[model samples]
Target: MDLINGFITIFSSPITMLFIVMGSVLGVVVGAVPGLTASAAIAMLVPITYYIDPLSALAFLYVIGKAGRFGGSISAILFNTPGTTAAAATILDGHPMTQKGQAGKALKTASISSAIGDFTGEILLICGALTIATFTKQLGPPEYFAIYVCAFLIIGSVISSSVLKGIVSTLFGASLAMIGLDPITSEPRFTFGTIELYNGLSLVPLLIGLFVISEVFTQASHDHSKDGRHDTIKAKNPDDDHLSMAEVKRCLPFIGKGSAIGSVVGLLPGVGSAVACFVAYGEGRRKAKNGDKWGTGVIEGIAAPESANNAVSGPSMIPLLALGVPGSTIAAMLLGVFMIHGIQVGPQIFETSGDIVYGLFAAGLIGIVLYFLIGWFGSAFIGRQIDKVPPIMIYPSILAVACVSAYTARSSLFDVGLACLFGVIGYLMRVTNLSTAAAVIAFVLAPGAEQALRQSLLLSDNGFAIFMDRPVALAFFAIPVFAISLRIYSRMRSEKTPAEMLDTA
Candidate 1:
């Protein structure tokens, strides 16, 4: 079968296997460092793969994705900082568990949950890709445009803690994404005639500045909570770790629920890991008989987030592989890396790169085994020791990686400087509660929307009614209507609360 052939190609060459191993290790390191994420890790490594076989190149990135999913938990448990937003929920109970000296239990539950969730996602991805390929063969740009509108509405409404802020963020992102090239004429519309404005702002450097560098600046301005932790984190040893089986059993149910939540949520483009975790935790507690005691360092509290966040890593790849639509902000960055490497995604990818495609799938399966080998066999020694790394030392190393990634993603030193500048802006955005997720989502969907809008208009002889000509487009328009209705209803209901009336007055 094609799958077997793909795995053979990946493993037949010892070089490919070596890269997988190296990438997994490096991914963990990147994920461990606060501010650095899996997407940045893959981008930093992508250029290194240009000369290698495509299968090997993909294999390396696959490992990074797998390990990066788990790596974020390392920081979330050790410190309150989550390396990825997916791990944000992990800090809710993980850091508290660590403070309680139940660090081993928390880490163990997290590791197992992550592994199971990731494995489940891989299964769904393989199945979904095959089905999607068969069903979507006839999809046109108009269909894609409708999907983009749907995505904007869903992500804007669901991802934001505040729907109003979320809606605003989505609009802001769209406006910025429209800054450079005109989709129809390829003429510059918003560029003010400056060379710097011609290309619009680059996303990778902007992401680096906003997510990684800005956090460093923000942290610099604050007086951190002091536990007098060590400056540098050493690599964890696989030996000398310990855990009780009773605790492991207690976490199993949570892991199962988390994985289930991840598999379902990840199928959507905008949900991402953070949403998965919060949803999983809420659902798990809702389903638990001992729900009242859920937050007091229970295994369920730890396992739910650990499973959901990691599970997303595999399923999030579904859109990227099937439609070239990225499911998460990090996946968007990886899409750039794939483009840079001359790897074209979409239905044809399976036909053209069966070996590479299959290899990536097989790698996810094998990575589970590798994760267990590292996390289970080595946690006691690695977990306790890794917990001591302070933010000051860890953050700078993240900036270094981001700088390298910005340069690598674009092959421009200007990207590095731009990333730093964006870092400052990102920091300010965080302080003001502006949504970076909104911006990233906007960047990814903007080009497609513009292309579709123009194409549809041309086909319709420049009539604005083109959007309602198709059932799909009509449904897409319903999104804004639905979102607005929900916002209004929620607002009207909220008006009766004493706190709301006080704020309004």
Candidate 2:
């Protein structure tokens, strides 16, 4: 009944529907462009949420996140360039099909598989988030703090090729989070006498600088003028342009397996769509009848990765909705939106904002359908259109929009300057191969972690011995230790193989 009302809420508003439509279209356009990502688009548009109703704002951005995942397949298939990191796995078979003049077939396969996978993940989210929240709500400050520690370690360890670099990025973000007044004492710590620093850094500027403006800086340094253009391959036959029932049947098993893999991965904090897609692709290949033919334009190859890539969109939100922990960069951005709207996330969110939560879920379903149709009927056209606009032109416009968006957040010149400063910092981090996503997630989680730790300590009668009494907290703390150990063991084992070492690098 709540879900139905949620649908009604979205349907009742013409403006909300319009935003969903616009977001879907824009998401595809943005994701079809190489070197642009859904995260950057969401960061640039976050300020616009301040002017709209919470449901409308959440729906708009949420839909874009959904649609954008599918849109990345457009460029991956058409140009061999992944519009987003998640689409990297798709290129294995996607571009090969395009080179074989079966681009339409690959695109359609991707569209169908992505929709099915995303739908599966959404259903799991709607069913599982509330259930998980029930248990999460029972947790005390000690358990919450333990969960935070687990997240920090897992994210820092897995997000980058270099575990040390990833941990450093996480620590850097945590340090930045400590720059303002102490939450408990209300005394300033690192303000350095700047009044603006008293409030710490605004998420708007940080997000814009790290994801949006930094990309602009990176793109600006690249010489797009000398980049070679690849022409879109035309289908050799009408059948090559349309997905057949036989093809769908053959791809169904891979799609299902990929969706399952993606949903499970999404539930784990810090493991993202890129990992899910590649894992799904590898698993599908290992199990497929045509295993040897996996990489040479097999439709199953496209089905596996595309499905898993988009499937991560929904279940990744589970941690955010249930435990107030963001599992991915997109979820971290959404966390900012939730705070901006004065909506509390986590277990209490269902009781406090059920309508908006369910409506967001409804919006996600509608978005999946919208993007599926667009991908099926118009992806080729959208891909060609994006190809016409060179990166040299696209990035400057994005830089301008990012600056304006930053200023719009608080209408402050200082925020804009802060954004530019972080832009340089972000550029350096990217060039240094550090995990910006890990840093952003840590920045968002640090305050809550600090509060939980302080609160737990305040309640403790026996100092550090309090954690010893809590089994759940102990279990939570153990997760990161186990994960880090497994990662180290795997790295040690892989070191013996030169090819595996190269792949790991």
Candidate 3:
């Protein structure tokens, strides 16, 4: 009944409908452009949400996130360049299909599989988030703190190739998050005597800097002088441009499996679409009968990764809605939006803002249909248009927009400067293989973790031993320890040479 009202609310508002449509179109265009991600687009546009109503803002950004994941496949198939990191796995077979003159078929397969996978994840989100939130609401401060610790460790350990670097990145973000006044004490901590610093760094500027401006800086560093025109491969046969029923039937199993894998991955904080897509692709190949053909223009190959990539969109919101922990970079940005609108997230969200929550869910359903239609009929055209816009032109414009957006957040020049500073830091993190995503997530989660820990301590008569009394807290604490140990064991095993293995035998 709430959901039906949500649909009615959206359908009745022309402005809301217009924003959704615009978001769908813009998300595709941004995602189709190589080096431009949905995260960057969202970060740049987040400041704009300050002027809009909460539902419209949430609906617009939410749809963009959904559409953007699908749009990445456009560049991956047409140009062999992944528009976002999640689309990297798509390139394994997507570009190969284009080279084989089956770009249309691959795009169609990707669109269908992505829609199916995303739909599956959305159903899980609608059903699962509230249920999870119900359970989470029963947890005390000890449990919440432990959960935050688990998130910090798991995100730091898993997001980057090097565990040390990932941990360092997370610590860096936590340190930055500490720069404001102490919340409980109301005492200045790391302000360094600046009035603005007393309130803490603005998230809008920080996000714009890290995701949007950083990408601009990275792209500006690249040489586009030798870049030439990429010709679109025409289908050799008319059938090559069309997907048949048999092909869809054959791809269904892989699509289902990919969606499942993606949903599970999305439940884990900071294990993002990039990981989900690759994992799904690898699993699909392992289970497929003609696995050897995976890399050679197989429509099944396109279906697997594309499904998993987009499927992460919905379930990734579960943590935020349930536990107030963002599971992805996009979710982190949305956290800022929720705060901006004075809507408290977490278990009480459905109780407090049930209409808005249900409305957002309805908007997501509408977005899925809209993006699917656009992807099915116009992905090729979007790809061609994006291809014409050179990196030289795009990055500068993005840089300008990022700067303007940063400034717009607070109408402060200091925020713009802060953004530029973080852009350099973000670029450095990128070049050094550090997880910027981990840093952002940590920045968002750290304050809550600190509060929870402090509150738990205050409640405890036996100091640290209080955690021992709670089985749930203990379980949460044990997770990171177990994960880190397992990671170390795996690394050691992988590092062993053939000679070492033989000697051990």
| CA lDDT of every candidate | 0.72, 0.91, 0.90
Task: Give the best candidate by TM-score.
Answer: 2
Q: Over the full model, what C-alpha lDDT does candidate 1 score relative to the true structure?
A: 0.72
Which of 1 and 3 is the better model by lDDT? 3
Clashes of each: 4, 0, 0
Query: Which residue pairs collide, candidate 2?
Result: none
lDDT string, candidate 3, 1-505, tens digits: 8889999999999889989998899888888888988998999999999999999999999999999998999999999999888899899899999998999999999999999999999989999999999999999999999999999999999889889998999999999999989999989988999998999988988898888888888888888897767898899999999999999999999999999999999888888888889888888988889888888889888898889988898999999999998878899989999999999988889999988888899899899899999999999988988888777877888888899999998899999999999999999999999988888989999999999999999999999899999999999999989988998999887886423432332
Error of 3 at 399 (Å): 0.8
Model 3 misplaced regions, further than 4 Å: 495-505
Best by lDDT: 2
> How much is 462 displaced in model 1, in angstroms?
6.9
lDDT of each residue in 1-505, candidate 2, tens digit only: 8889889999999889899998899888888888899999999999999999999999999889888888999999999999888899899899999999999999999999999999999999999999999999999999999999999999999998888998999999888899889998999988899999898889999999999999999998888877656787788999989999999999999999999999999888889988899889888988888978877999999999899988888999999999999988889989999999999998999999999999999999998999999999999989888877777877888899999999999888899999999899999999998988999999999999999999999999997788999999999999989999998998887654422432332
TM of each candidate vs. truth: 0.84, 0.98, 0.97
Superposed model 1: Cα runs more than 4 Å off? 34-36, 39-58, 78-83, 91-102, 179-183, 196-201, 225-227, 230-252, 409-411, 479-505
Candidates arranged by TM-score, highest first = 2, 3, 1
| Per-residue lDDT of candidate 1, residues 370-399 (tens digit) | 765666555444544555666677666766
